[model samples]
Target: MPVRSPLYLLERFDPGVVQLDRELRVIAMNSLARRLLPVEDKQPFEKMVLSFHPERSVAKVKFLLDQAECPVSNPPPMTMIINIPERVLLIKVSKLSDLRGDTTGYTLIFYDITELVSGELPVQPMTPESLSIEKPAPAKRQLHKIPTVSQNRIVLVDVETVTYIRSEGHYTWVSTAQGSSFCNLNISDLAERLDGASFLRIHRSYLANLDFAEQILRDEGRVSLKLRGETTPLPVARTSVSRLLEQLGIGEVDAQRT
Candidate 1:
């Protein structure tokens, strides 16, 4: 079978494309990619692909590229959704090969979906009936499984398995005994969707599951929490300490006289 050209596949969608050599250096990119990526001022064509992305995102991009390589012909493209500043991008990576079926390079294509996922689209205004004080507020539904991404696929993590969630800009890192995976939803959104009784906001950046609470470490007025399986302690805000203790059914033991 003949090798399929990256340009041939790129013709189907109006997406940003960045072509890379086997060494992972940028070989070429479409005009759309140059405009969307943060490489306008620098000579980025010959630089490594990882250099163009944020430090936090380098691992994810590397994972995407690694997953794209396959010995089989016409392998499925690896896909991932990532957030950057005000924009969200849906990225896909496919490996390029030579006529002898040897790996030659890679092609990364991305489409912007910020408006679709970030609530930037216009919404309908509430009517008087919808805002009536007579009506009680609807109960927030608890999330059973958090939507997370691993490799090139989306994984649904059971709520009970989650130990904590850390906010990263508009996205989050969902951590469990298995490991941490990227979540597209922000911490605030997860807080609203999770069971209020089980999940507690310990700090601006951390939401911890009370079920996994092992110890509360206090040092010099600063408070942090240790989970059953996790080694590192999660920082607890000064304001949230009292509420955290109360939620754990300990009830401000520090305030009690010895």
Candidate 2:
């Protein structure tokens, strides 16, 4: 929710990159995106969709393309699975903001989750007792949880695979290595549902999984935490930096939030 550095964000979305105008014309594309383009239709993105499995998905794809032309009413990150020639790509669509902080277009970051679908890497379920945080004495009221991420459907998610939970206006987005989904609960409500040892709230808008905490980055006076499966760094609060580092088993060396 703070001013995020665009430079790092660009780095986060490495490999798959495609820039489009409001009308959905391909303005610029990286080498990876270029490679995926069909030989005959190198002109514009809207006219040329590479390949799709179910025919109905084509219409859904177009709706998302149109959603990116301007600022989105609810930006919780939309994800769709599309099949291209020989590969299955997981496209994560995020809103791209302009100088005035208005939504300009959308950015599509592609990830190949074919192997995962093929049963190579499986989604592990996380239990509250399996985490490694200090336990407080049992409370009078029993705290029950499903440890599941739900949008339209519900799937039990392991705490280890959870990357982060972010607040987007009234909704909280829960993202795992498997995928991301919108939760009906607010950030505070979602945080209480997660295991304390593994999940920590770094910012008022961000709760992170320590298991995925890869590195802590301090760039241009802003401190952020880089998770394993994500390209973007989740912003950390200046006041909670020390405590977060301790929870993640990271040493201190001038970590501050912008």
User: Top lDDT: which candidate number?
Assistant: 1
Error of 1 at 54 (Å): 0.8
Q: Candidate 2, which segments miss by more than 4 Å at Cα?
A: 1-151, 254-258
lDDT of candidate 2 over 1-258, digit per residue (tens): 554332333234335667665555566776666554532444655644424224534554675566445344555665554443333445656677767777676666665433333332332222234221345533221112223334422333444566898887645677877778665345765566457888899999999988788878887767898999899998988888888978866567534331
- The weakest ten consecutive residues by lDDT in model 2 span 139-148
Clashing pairs in 2: 125-158, 126-158, 126-159
Indicate the TM-score of model 1: 0.53
RMSD of 1: 11.6
The CA lDDT at 65 in model 1 is 84
Q: Tens digits of per-residue lDDT for model 1 on 97-180?
A: 889888889999887543333323332223345434457864544567676777656566788999999999767999999999
Q: Highest TM-score, which number?
A: 1
For model 1 the local lDDT of residue 230 reads: 99
